[model samples]
Target: MKKILTLVVLSFTLTMNAFAAQKLDVEVNGLVCDFCAQALEKVFGKKESVKEIDVNLTERYVRITLNEGKEIADEEVKKLIIDAGYDVVKINRVEE
Candidate 1:
């Protein structure tokens, strides 16, 4: 009975971790126009981890809300931006 109880608690913890929401803010360079923002939105929109994307051309930043339990590495974000023909100035986690 004790073993079963322990197993249940462990499973619950793991499941919660997997579904936790997260957000990231990335400052970028060369976001000069709405078209550029659209290009970036299109690129990030396809990512499974990305639940929402908000691009501010005037602020030169992209805010991404990650799906529950999904997280992205800084290097991967930088690479994705680079792949989309943009330059990443900085990337940081948005503390909840």
Candidate 2:
């Protein structure tokens, strides 16, 4: 019984850690120029929890990484990108 309990606790901790390191891939429209990309970066960069950001101009995708145990809502991220003078086509949470 003790062994089983230990395993259960370990499993829960691992699951929570996995969720904490979640990364999201957001695809946006009208990301045609450097200025527009810069704007998007600026908005997300301001977030304290954001760890890294990658922008693909050709694919019009923005990949964002949040610090461990940190996450920004989809709507909030989308709104930030939209406010930067572009349209958020879609936001998807990438699987690890």
Candidate 1 Cα errors over 4 Å, as ranges: 1-18
Residue 27's lDDT in candidate 1: 97
| Candidate No. with top lDDT | 1
Worst 10 residues of 1 by lDDT: 14-23
Candidate 2 lowest-lDDT run of ten: 15-24
Q: Which residue pairs come into collision in candidate 2?
A: none
Runs off by more than 4 Å, candidate 2: 2-20
Model 1 agreement with the true structure over 32-76: per-residue lDDT tens digits: 988899998999999998999999887889999998878889999
The digit string of per-residue lDDT tens for model 2 on 5-91 reads 999999998888767766888888888888887887888899987988889999889999888778789989888887888888788
Q: Report, for every candidate in turn, its global Cα lDDT versus the true structure.
A: 0.90, 0.85
Candidate 1 CA-lDDT value: 0.90
